[model samples]
Target: MVFFKKIVLMSAVLALAGLTGCATKSDKAGYAENVVYHVNDSVVAGAAMNNIKNHLNANPQAKIVLVTHGKGIDFLLEGAMDDKGNPYNVRVQELKAKGVTFDVCNNTLVGRKIDPKTVLPEAVIVPSGVAEVAKLQSQKNFAYVKP
Candidate 1:
């Protein structure tokens, strides 16, 4: 019985490995993939920006979409700042210039009672950030990253 159980476990592991291997081969290169970066918290917004910048630097042809909701949308607002008072618009604009798309959740704005006019012009207001992330990953084959 023990030997049979071991064989079953090994088979399961091998099957999973095969699936993972096949999944990773979707892109010609790691950085050349369509990527969606999810940001639900403002605390990591700065780090997310850096990560997107690094991704673009590594692969200029890569397509990157940043989906923001909840507190994460704070960074994309006009005149937004970090803990140190560094303005976020400059970095956001720089990334935008490099072809990074920023998406803000309209659901978040309605739920939080934030004015849509307050959002920066650069960001596209999606109906739902989570749904947008899902659509990118499932329908668009975008690799998901949360940094």
Candidate 2:
């Protein structure tokens, strides 16, 4: 019985040793992989969307957050179309499927007089787009991109 107790204690110690570094390692990995994309220009919206697609294609596991304000919110508006006359829904939905989150600025809606109900179904409205981007960078160490 003493020998069995010793074996069990050694196994427990080994298991604990293996788990000791997991928290820090996992945290570092998440900080490195988290990314934020900011879009405030209506003209470059298409390019920005394409860039996000390429980024996700390259890093399938990367966490992507897109924050939009000002004219940037145009693309998320209902019945919106790009210069090619193509609706933005298909691409937006595709990105959403790949775990990309789209955040619209509530301040923009109020300032621009855009109806909140007109925002794309998948997008979430935050209090402020600029503040959201800053929060992600300062608090979560997310890499910021303006593409």
Candidate 3:
């Protein structure tokens, strides 16, 4: 009787462990499938862009969009370079090649007295940065991230 009870307890424990392992694997797979990143800082924009690139490489069908406004617009400004002195235009182009879309806010341009033509050619101008963020969240269901 003692040996039979020990076997039953061990079986229950093993069953629970197996279920937990399956749950963890499913979570990881879900994470890789639907991942969105939002970049709102100029200083760390490069790192965020790099992360997007890595995600795209891992999941070729991933959808990626970057929203820049306020001070973040500095990352896509014409002639703006990173800390390494590499032109931001080059980085934007590379990321574009990997299927990343960059959205620029018109409010920032007006507030800063910057001409739209002065920004990267690939950037799309939106009505307002804050509103645009809201629209993306509500309509498109894009994940908001500030790196």
Q: What TM-score does each of the candidates earn? A: 0.79, 0.78, 0.76
- The parts of candidate 2 lying over 4 Å away from their true place are 1-32
- Poorly placed runs, candidate 1 (over 4 Å): 1-31
Q: What is the C-alpha lDDT of each candidate?
A: 0.92, 0.89, 0.79
Q: Give the TM-score of candidate 2.
A: 0.78
Kindly list the per-residue Cα lDDT of model 2 for residues 34-137, writing each as its tens digit: 88999998678789889988877666778999999999989998988998999998888999999999999999999989899999998999999999999999
* Candidate achieving the largest TM-score: 1
Point out the higher-scoring one by TM-score: 1 or 3: 1
| lDDT (Cα, 0-100) at 128 in candidate 1 | 97
Estimate, for each residue in 1-147, the C-alpha lDDT of model 3 and write its tens digit.
999999999999999999877764324532434334555669888898888877776666666778888888898888898998989888799888867888888988998899999889888888877787787788877767766
Candidate 3: 10-residue stretch with minimal lDDT:
25-34
Over 1-147, each residue of candidate 1 has an lDDT whose tens digit, in order, gives 999999999999999999878864435444466999999998999999999998877677889999999999999998899999999998989999988999999999999999999999889999999999999999999999999
Error of 2 at 120 (Å): 0.5
Model 3's alpha-carbon lDDT is 0.79
Among the numbered candidates, top lDDT falls to 1
